[model samples]
Target chain A: MYSPACKVTDIASLIPQRSPIMMVDDYIIEDELNCRSELAVGADNMFLDETGRLSVEGVLEHIAQTAAAHIGYLHRQAGETVTLGYIGDIKRCAVTGPLPAVGTTLHTHVTVISQVGDVSLVSAETSAENNPILNCRMKVAEG
Target chain B: MEKDELVKKMIEILADEFEVEPEVIQPEANIKETMHLDSLSLVDMVGLVNEEFGVEIKTPDLPTIKTFADLYDYVFTRM
Candidate 1:
Protein backbone atom coordinates (compact mmCIF):
# COMPACT_ATOMS: atom_id res chain seq x y z
CA MET A 1 0.00 0.00 0.00
CA TYR A 2 1.26 3.47 -0.78
CA SER A 3 1.98 5.63 2.26
CA PRO A 4 0.31 8.88 3.06
CA ALA A 5 2.00 12.06 1.85
CA CYS A 6 4.38 13.66 4.35
CA LYS A 7 4.63 17.39 4.17
CA VAL A 8 8.19 18.64 3.63
CA THR A 9 8.24 22.24 4.59
CA ASP A 10 10.88 24.94 3.99
CA ILE A 11 14.36 23.92 2.90
CA ALA A 12 15.80 25.63 6.01
CA SER A 13 14.08 23.10 8.30
CA LEU A 14 16.07 20.30 6.72
CA ILE A 15 19.41 21.51 5.42
CA PRO A 16 21.68 24.51 5.89
CA GLN A 17 20.36 26.66 3.02
CA ARG A 18 21.60 30.22 3.03
CA SER A 19 19.22 32.71 1.46
CA PRO A 20 19.19 32.53 -2.34
CA ILE A 21 21.09 29.28 -2.22
CA MET A 22 18.09 27.12 -1.34
CA MET A 23 15.80 25.66 -4.01
CA VAL A 24 12.42 23.88 -3.90
CA ASP A 25 9.17 25.11 -2.44
CA ASP A 26 8.84 22.04 -0.21
CA TYR A 27 9.88 18.40 -0.29
CA ILE A 28 7.07 15.92 0.41
CA ILE A 29 8.38 12.40 -0.04
CA GLU A 30 10.70 10.51 2.32
CA ASP A 31 11.07 7.48 4.54
CA GLU A 32 13.79 5.44 6.18
CA LEU A 33 14.07 3.26 3.11
CA ASN A 34 13.37 5.70 0.26
CA CYS A 35 12.57 9.28 -0.76
CA ARG A 36 10.74 11.09 -3.59
CA SER A 37 9.27 14.54 -4.16
CA GLU A 38 8.70 17.45 -6.53
CA LEU A 39 9.85 21.05 -6.61
CA ALA A 40 9.20 23.96 -8.96
CA VAL A 41 11.62 26.51 -10.36
CA GLY A 42 10.35 29.77 -9.06
CA ALA A 43 11.47 33.28 -9.88
CA ASP A 44 14.22 33.02 -7.28
CA ASN A 45 17.23 30.65 -7.21
CA MET A 46 20.81 31.24 -8.38
CA PHE A 47 20.93 28.25 -10.70
CA LEU A 48 20.07 30.28 -13.77
CA ASP A 49 22.65 29.34 -16.38
CA GLU A 50 24.07 31.38 -19.25
CA THR A 51 20.91 30.50 -21.15
CA GLY A 52 18.92 32.08 -18.33
CA ARG A 53 17.27 28.71 -17.79
CA LEU A 54 17.05 26.57 -14.68
CA SER A 55 20.22 24.56 -15.06
CA VAL A 56 20.83 20.85 -14.92
CA GLU A 57 23.27 21.55 -12.11
CA GLY A 58 20.50 23.33 -10.28
CA VAL A 59 18.24 20.35 -10.82
CA LEU A 60 20.94 18.16 -9.32
CA GLU A 61 21.16 20.39 -6.27
CA HIS A 62 17.39 20.48 -5.99
CA ILE A 63 17.22 16.71 -6.09
CA ALA A 64 20.00 16.47 -3.53
CA GLN A 65 18.10 18.84 -1.29
CA THR A 66 15.05 16.64 -1.68
CA ALA A 67 17.15 13.71 -0.54
CA ALA A 68 18.08 15.68 2.55
CA ALA A 69 14.41 16.33 3.17
CA HIS A 70 13.82 12.61 3.25
CA ILE A 71 16.40 12.29 5.97
CA GLY A 72 14.83 15.14 7.90
CA TYR A 73 11.37 13.68 7.57
CA LEU A 74 12.43 10.30 8.80
CA HIS A 75 14.18 11.89 11.74
CA ARG A 76 11.26 14.14 12.62
CA GLN A 77 8.86 11.25 12.33
CA ALA A 78 10.93 9.56 15.02
CA GLY A 79 10.88 12.63 17.29
CA GLU A 80 14.30 13.88 16.21
CA THR A 81 14.84 17.56 15.45
CA VAL A 82 17.54 17.56 12.80
CA THR A 83 20.87 15.96 11.98
CA LEU A 84 23.91 17.25 10.15
CA GLY A 85 24.71 15.71 6.81
CA TYR A 86 26.58 16.29 3.56
CA ILE A 87 26.60 14.79 0.07
CA GLY A 88 29.75 12.72 -0.30
CA ASP A 89 29.85 11.97 -3.99
CA ILE A 90 27.58 12.79 -6.90
CA LYS A 91 28.73 10.03 -9.17
CA ARG A 92 27.12 8.77 -12.35
CA CYS A 93 25.10 11.92 -12.53
CA ALA A 94 23.23 12.64 -15.76
CA VAL A 95 21.03 15.54 -16.77
CA THR A 96 18.79 16.43 -19.78
CA GLY A 97 17.14 19.76 -19.52
CA PRO A 98 17.24 23.30 -20.84
CA LEU A 99 17.63 24.27 -17.17
CA PRO A 100 17.14 27.55 -15.29
CA ALA A 101 13.89 27.94 -17.16
CA VAL A 102 10.72 28.65 -15.26
CA GLY A 103 7.52 26.60 -15.65
CA THR A 104 9.45 23.43 -14.89
CA THR A 105 9.01 21.10 -11.92
CA LEU A 106 11.24 18.20 -11.07
CA HIS A 107 10.13 14.96 -9.51
CA THR A 108 13.01 13.78 -7.34
CA HIS A 109 13.37 10.26 -6.09
CA VAL A 110 16.04 8.57 -3.97
CA THR A 111 16.42 4.97 -2.83
CA VAL A 112 18.83 3.60 -0.28
CA ILE A 113 21.31 1.23 -1.82
CA SER A 114 23.42 0.33 1.22
CA GLN A 115 24.09 1.74 4.65
CA VAL A 116 27.42 1.06 6.25
CA GLY A 117 27.31 2.74 9.63
CA ASP A 118 26.26 6.40 9.27
CA VAL A 119 26.82 6.61 5.55
CA SER A 120 24.15 5.72 2.99
CA LEU A 121 24.61 5.27 -0.72
CA VAL A 122 21.47 6.50 -2.44
CA SER A 123 20.35 5.85 -5.98
CA ALA A 124 18.60 8.95 -7.17
CA GLU A 125 16.60 10.05 -10.23
CA THR A 126 14.73 13.25 -10.97
CA SER A 127 12.29 13.77 -13.80
CA ALA A 128 10.15 16.49 -15.31
CA GLU A 129 7.17 15.85 -17.55
CA ASN A 130 8.14 12.23 -17.14
CA ASN A 131 11.41 13.04 -18.86
CA PRO A 132 14.55 12.54 -16.84
CA ILE A 133 16.26 15.63 -15.63
CA LEU A 134 19.01 13.96 -13.66
CA ASN A 135 20.08 10.64 -12.14
CA CYS A 136 22.98 9.89 -9.84
CA ARG A 137 24.45 7.86 -7.02
CA MET A 138 24.92 9.97 -3.95
CA LYS A 139 26.75 9.21 -0.71
CA VAL A 140 25.39 10.79 2.44
CA ALA A 141 27.49 11.37 5.57
CA GLU A 142 25.83 11.95 8.90
CA GLY A 143 27.36 13.83 11.82
CA MET B 1 54.42 13.31 -13.27
CA GLU B 2 55.09 15.57 -16.20
CA LYS B 3 53.21 18.88 -16.45
CA ASP B 4 51.91 17.78 -19.84
CA GLU B 5 50.51 14.66 -18.26
CA LEU B 6 48.81 16.70 -15.56
CA VAL B 7 47.32 18.99 -18.18
CA LYS B 8 45.97 15.98 -19.99
CA LYS B 9 44.37 14.77 -16.77
CA MET B 10 42.89 18.17 -16.00
CA ILE B 11 41.44 18.26 -19.47
CA GLU B 12 40.10 14.81 -18.94
CA ILE B 13 38.48 15.85 -15.67
CA LEU B 14 36.85 18.88 -17.29
CA ALA B 15 35.66 16.75 -20.14
CA ASP B 16 34.24 14.25 -17.71
CA GLU B 17 32.61 16.95 -15.62
CA PHE B 18 31.00 18.57 -18.63
CA GLU B 19 30.30 15.33 -20.45
CA VAL B 20 32.08 16.65 -23.50
CA GLU B 21 34.90 15.45 -25.69
CA PRO B 22 38.49 16.27 -24.63
CA GLU B 23 39.20 17.56 -28.14
CA VAL B 24 36.61 20.27 -27.61
CA ILE B 25 38.69 21.56 -24.68
CA GLN B 26 41.20 24.13 -25.86
CA PRO B 27 44.59 23.80 -24.14
CA GLU B 28 44.86 27.60 -24.09
CA ALA B 29 41.15 28.24 -23.59
CA ASN B 30 39.18 29.68 -20.70
CA ILE B 31 36.89 27.06 -19.20
CA LYS B 32 34.06 29.55 -18.77
CA GLU B 33 34.56 30.69 -22.28
CA THR B 34 34.04 27.28 -23.81
CA MET B 35 32.14 25.52 -21.03
CA HIS B 36 29.23 26.99 -19.10
CA LEU B 37 29.91 25.55 -15.68
CA ASP B 38 28.70 27.15 -12.48
CA SER B 39 30.36 27.68 -9.10
CA LEU B 40 29.13 24.42 -7.63
CA SER B 41 30.74 22.62 -10.54
CA LEU B 42 33.93 24.47 -9.81
CA VAL B 43 33.71 23.35 -6.20
CA ASP B 44 33.07 19.79 -7.30
CA MET B 45 36.05 19.98 -9.67
CA VAL B 46 38.21 21.23 -6.83
CA GLY B 47 37.09 18.30 -4.74
CA LEU B 48 37.81 15.92 -7.58
CA VAL B 49 41.28 17.41 -8.01
CA ASN B 50 41.97 17.29 -4.29
CA GLU B 51 40.82 13.72 -3.95
CA GLU B 52 42.75 12.58 -6.97
CA PHE B 53 45.94 14.58 -6.30
CA GLY B 54 45.76 15.29 -2.54
CA VAL B 55 45.92 19.03 -3.05
CA GLU B 56 44.01 21.95 -1.62
CA ILE B 57 42.29 23.91 -4.42
CA LYS B 58 40.57 27.06 -3.34
CA THR B 59 38.18 29.06 -5.53
CA PRO B 60 40.69 31.87 -5.72
CA ASP B 61 43.22 29.48 -7.20
CA LEU B 62 40.85 28.87 -10.10
CA PRO B 63 41.81 32.23 -11.57
CA THR B 64 45.16 30.77 -12.51
CA ILE B 65 43.51 28.13 -14.67
CA LYS B 66 43.25 29.73 -18.09
CA THR B 67 44.22 26.91 -20.41
CA PHE B 68 44.50 23.15 -20.11
CA ALA B 69 48.25 23.70 -19.91
CA ASP B 70 47.84 26.07 -16.98
CA LEU B 71 45.69 23.58 -15.12
CA TYR B 72 48.18 20.82 -15.84
CA ASP B 73 51.16 22.89 -14.69
CA TYR B 74 49.41 24.04 -11.50
CA VAL B 75 48.20 20.64 -10.42
CA PHE B 76 51.49 19.00 -11.41
CA THR B 77 53.43 21.56 -9.39
CA ARG B 78 51.37 22.23 -6.23
CA MET B 79 49.26 19.09 -6.11
Candidate 2:
Protein backbone atom coordinates (compact mmCIF):
# COMPACT_ATOMS: atom_id res chain seq x y z
CA MET A 1 0.00 0.00 0.00
CA TYR A 2 1.16 3.55 -0.78
CA SER A 3 1.17 6.48 1.60
CA PRO A 4 -1.50 9.08 1.01
CA ALA A 5 0.76 11.75 -0.53
CA CYS A 6 4.16 13.44 -0.45
CA LYS A 7 5.58 16.78 -1.53
CA VAL A 8 6.91 16.80 -5.10
CA THR A 9 10.11 18.63 -4.14
CA ASP A 10 11.01 15.92 -1.61
CA ILE A 11 10.77 13.18 -4.24
CA ALA A 12 13.98 14.10 -6.09
CA SER A 13 15.93 12.63 -3.19
CA LEU A 14 14.41 9.23 -3.94
CA ILE A 15 14.24 9.17 -7.77
CA PRO A 16 17.05 9.55 -10.28
CA GLN A 17 16.60 12.42 -12.70
CA ARG A 18 19.44 14.50 -14.12
CA SER A 19 18.82 17.45 -16.42
CA PRO A 20 16.44 17.20 -19.34
CA ILE A 21 14.52 14.24 -17.97
CA MET A 22 13.81 16.03 -14.69
CA MET A 23 10.79 17.89 -15.95
CA VAL A 24 8.86 18.42 -12.72
CA ASP A 25 10.05 21.62 -11.08
CA ASP A 26 8.29 21.17 -7.74
CA TYR A 27 5.20 19.79 -6.01
CA ILE A 28 2.65 21.05 -3.47
CA ILE A 29 0.75 19.14 -0.83
CA GLU A 30 -1.83 20.42 1.68
CA ASP A 31 -3.67 18.58 4.42
CA GLU A 32 -2.50 15.28 2.91
CA LEU A 33 -4.05 16.18 -0.41
CA ASN A 34 -1.70 16.28 -3.41
CA CYS A 35 -2.63 19.23 -5.57
CA ARG A 36 -0.81 21.60 -7.99
CA SER A 37 2.81 21.43 -9.22
CA GLU A 38 5.07 22.77 -11.92
CA LEU A 39 7.30 21.16 -14.58
CA ALA A 40 10.03 22.76 -16.68
CA VAL A 41 10.80 21.99 -20.31
CA GLY A 42 14.46 21.99 -21.32
CA ALA A 43 15.40 23.84 -24.51
CA ASP A 44 18.09 21.30 -25.36
CA ASN A 45 16.07 18.29 -26.53
CA MET A 46 15.68 17.71 -30.27
CA PHE A 47 11.99 17.18 -29.72
CA LEU A 48 11.91 20.81 -28.51
CA ASP A 49 13.76 23.48 -30.45
CA GLU A 50 15.34 26.57 -28.89
CA THR A 51 12.47 28.37 -30.59
CA GLY A 52 10.21 26.38 -28.20
CA ARG A 53 8.57 24.62 -31.12
CA LEU A 54 7.89 20.87 -30.79
CA SER A 55 6.00 18.04 -32.39
CA VAL A 56 2.58 16.92 -31.17
CA GLU A 57 4.24 13.71 -30.04
CA GLY A 58 6.79 15.69 -28.06
CA VAL A 59 4.04 17.61 -26.32
CA LEU A 60 2.36 14.32 -25.49
CA GLU A 61 5.58 12.87 -24.02
CA HIS A 62 6.09 15.90 -21.81
CA ILE A 63 2.55 15.61 -20.51
CA ALA A 64 3.07 11.92 -19.86
CA GLN A 65 6.29 12.58 -17.96
CA THR A 66 4.55 15.14 -15.78
CA ALA A 67 2.03 12.44 -14.91
CA ALA A 68 4.99 10.20 -13.95
CA ALA A 69 6.12 12.88 -11.51
CA HIS A 70 2.99 12.33 -9.44
CA ILE A 71 3.58 8.58 -9.32
CA GLY A 72 7.14 9.18 -8.18
CA TYR A 73 5.92 11.25 -5.29
CA LEU A 74 3.40 8.59 -4.27
CA HIS A 75 6.06 5.88 -4.30
CA ARG A 76 8.39 7.82 -2.00
CA GLN A 77 5.57 8.37 0.49
CA ALA A 78 4.91 4.62 0.41
CA GLY A 79 8.50 3.94 1.61
CA GLU A 80 9.34 2.41 -1.76
CA THR A 81 11.81 3.54 -4.39
CA VAL A 82 10.60 4.45 -7.82
CA THR A 83 10.83 1.54 -10.26
CA LEU A 84 10.82 0.98 -14.02
CA GLY A 85 7.45 1.26 -15.68
CA TYR A 86 6.38 1.74 -19.28
CA ILE A 87 4.09 4.54 -20.55
CA GLY A 88 1.46 1.76 -20.67
CA ASP A 89 -1.27 3.28 -22.88
CA ILE A 90 -2.11 6.66 -24.42
CA LYS A 91 -5.55 6.93 -25.98
CA ARG A 92 -6.68 10.28 -27.38
CA CYS A 93 -3.58 12.31 -28.27
CA ALA A 94 -4.52 15.76 -29.50
CA VAL A 95 -1.98 18.55 -29.95
CA THR A 96 -1.99 21.88 -31.79
CA GLY A 97 1.65 23.10 -31.96
CA PRO A 98 5.04 22.82 -30.32
CA LEU A 99 4.56 23.44 -26.61
CA PRO A 100 4.62 27.26 -26.87
CA ALA A 101 7.68 28.21 -24.83
CA VAL A 102 11.36 28.85 -25.13
CA GLY A 103 10.99 27.07 -21.83
CA THR A 104 7.65 26.10 -20.35
CA THR A 105 6.45 26.04 -16.75
CA LEU A 106 3.57 23.59 -16.81
CA HIS A 107 1.17 23.40 -13.88
CA THR A 108 0.08 19.79 -13.48
CA HIS A 109 -2.93 18.34 -11.66
CA VAL A 110 -3.54 14.62 -11.13
CA THR A 111 -6.63 12.94 -9.65
CA VAL A 112 -7.21 9.30 -8.82
CA ILE A 113 -9.81 7.80 -11.12
CA SER A 114 -9.46 4.00 -11.07
CA GLN A 115 -7.31 1.13 -9.92
CA VAL A 116 -6.62 -2.31 -11.41
CA GLY A 117 -4.59 -4.79 -9.39
CA ASP A 118 -1.46 -3.09 -8.09
CA VAL A 119 -1.71 -0.37 -10.70
CA SER A 120 -3.29 2.94 -9.74
CA LEU A 121 -4.92 4.96 -12.51
CA VAL A 122 -4.89 8.75 -12.45
CA SER A 123 -6.33 11.38 -14.73
CA ALA A 124 -4.12 14.39 -15.46
CA GLU A 125 -4.39 17.81 -17.03
CA THR A 126 -1.77 20.53 -17.39
CA SER A 127 -1.35 24.08 -18.56
CA ALA A 128 1.88 25.74 -19.63
CA GLU A 129 2.28 29.17 -18.10
CA ASN A 130 -1.46 29.90 -18.36
CA ASN A 131 -2.86 27.93 -21.28
CA PRO A 132 -4.53 24.55 -21.06
CA ILE A 133 -2.42 22.00 -22.89
CA LEU A 134 -3.18 18.30 -22.49
CA ASN A 135 -5.18 15.69 -20.64
CA CYS A 136 -3.98 12.11 -20.09
CA ARG A 137 -4.87 8.93 -18.22
CA MET A 138 -1.89 7.51 -16.34
CA LYS A 139 -1.01 4.14 -14.76
CA VAL A 140 1.84 3.48 -12.33
CA ALA A 141 3.37 0.35 -10.82
CA GLU A 142 6.57 -0.94 -9.19
CA GLY A 143 8.50 -4.06 -10.17
CA MET B 1 -25.64 -4.61 -32.22
CA GLU B 2 -24.31 -8.13 -32.55
CA LYS B 3 -21.28 -8.94 -30.40
CA ASP B 4 -19.87 -11.35 -32.97
CA GLU B 5 -20.24 -8.85 -35.77
CA LEU B 6 -18.63 -6.14 -33.69
CA VAL B 7 -15.77 -8.47 -32.89
CA LYS B 8 -15.29 -9.20 -36.56
CA LYS B 9 -15.15 -5.50 -37.26
CA MET B 10 -12.69 -5.01 -34.45
CA ILE B 11 -10.51 -7.79 -35.86
CA GLU B 12 -10.45 -6.26 -39.32
CA ILE B 13 -9.72 -2.79 -37.97
CA LEU B 14 -6.97 -3.98 -35.65
CA ALA B 15 -5.32 -5.95 -38.44
CA ASP B 16 -5.43 -3.04 -40.84
CA GLU B 17 -4.20 -0.43 -38.37
CA PHE B 18 -1.56 -2.66 -36.77
CA GLU B 19 -0.71 -4.24 -40.13
CA VAL B 20 -1.49 -7.84 -39.14
CA GLU B 21 -4.24 -10.30 -40.06
CA PRO B 22 -7.85 -10.53 -38.90
CA GLU B 23 -7.31 -14.13 -37.82
CA VAL B 24 -4.41 -13.06 -35.65
CA ILE B 25 -6.80 -11.64 -33.02
CA GLN B 26 -9.22 -13.93 -31.22
CA PRO B 27 -12.03 -13.08 -28.81
CA GLU B 28 -9.90 -14.45 -26.01
CA ALA B 29 -6.93 -12.27 -27.00
CA ASN B 30 -6.03 -9.07 -25.22
CA ILE B 31 -4.82 -6.23 -27.42
CA LYS B 32 -1.95 -5.05 -25.22
CA GLU B 33 -1.69 -7.98 -22.83
CA THR B 34 -1.43 -10.65 -25.56
CA MET B 35 -0.75 -8.76 -28.81
CA HIS B 36 2.33 -7.05 -27.36
CA LEU B 37 1.12 -3.59 -28.37
CA ASP B 38 3.35 -0.85 -27.07
CA SER B 39 2.53 2.84 -26.49
CA LEU B 40 2.81 3.72 -30.16
CA SER B 41 0.50 0.87 -31.09
CA LEU B 42 -2.01 2.13 -28.55
CA VAL B 43 -2.00 5.50 -30.32
CA ASP B 44 -2.82 3.77 -33.55
CA MET B 45 -5.51 1.82 -31.77
CA VAL B 46 -7.15 5.10 -30.81
CA GLY B 47 -7.06 6.21 -34.41
CA LEU B 48 -8.76 2.97 -35.36
CA VAL B 49 -11.38 3.58 -32.70
CA ASN B 50 -11.97 7.03 -34.10
CA GLU B 51 -12.34 5.77 -37.65
CA GLU B 52 -14.25 2.61 -36.90
CA PHE B 53 -16.48 3.75 -34.09
CA GLY B 54 -16.41 7.55 -34.41
CA VAL B 55 -15.68 7.88 -30.72
CA GLU B 56 -13.04 10.30 -29.47
CA ILE B 57 -10.86 9.09 -26.60
CA LYS B 58 -7.83 10.50 -24.88
CA THR B 59 -4.65 8.40 -25.04
CA PRO B 60 -4.79 7.76 -21.30
CA ASP B 61 -8.24 6.14 -21.38
CA LEU B 62 -6.92 3.43 -23.71
CA PRO B 63 -4.52 2.03 -21.12
CA THR B 64 -7.21 1.90 -18.45
CA ILE B 65 -8.89 -0.83 -20.46
CA LYS B 66 -7.38 -4.22 -19.55
CA THR B 67 -9.30 -6.65 -21.70
CA PHE B 68 -11.29 -7.11 -24.91
CA ALA B 69 -14.47 -7.18 -22.90
CA ASP B 70 -13.63 -3.81 -21.44
CA LEU B 71 -12.94 -2.31 -24.86
CA TYR B 72 -16.05 -3.85 -26.33
CA ASP B 73 -18.11 -2.48 -23.51
CA TYR B 74 -16.62 0.97 -23.98
CA VAL B 75 -17.35 1.02 -27.71
CA PHE B 76 -20.85 -0.36 -27.31
CA THR B 77 -21.66 2.11 -24.58
CA ARG B 78 -20.61 5.00 -26.75
CA MET B 79 -22.81 3.82 -29.60
Candidate 1 lDDT for residue A132:
75
User: Which window of ten consecutive residues has the lowest lDDT sum in model 1 chain B?
Assistant: B38-47
TM-score versus the correct structure, for each prediction = 0.58, 0.53
The CAPRI category of model 1 is: incorrect
How well does candidate 2 match the true structure, expressed as C-alpha RMSD? 7.8
Kindly report which residue pairs in candidate 1 clash with one another. A53-A99, A53-A100, A53-A101, A54-A99, A54-A100, A54-A101, A55-A99, A55-A100, B7-B72
Task: Report the C-alpha lDDT of model 2 over B1-79, residue by residue, as the tens digit.
Answer: 6867787788777776676766767655677855677644555566467657876555467676777777877787786
What is the C-alpha local distance difference test score of candidate 1? 0.69
> Going through the candidates in order, what is chain B's TM-score?
0.78, 0.74
Q: Which ten residues in a row have the lowest lDDT in candidate 2 chain A?
A: A27-36
**Candidate 1 lDDT over residue span B1-79, tens digit each:** 7766776777777788778788888767777666665543555555567667777555567777776667667777785
lDDT of 2 at A61: 55
Tell me the lDDT of model 2 at B32: 84
Candidate 1 residues lying further than 4 Å off, grouped into runs, are: A1-3, B1-79
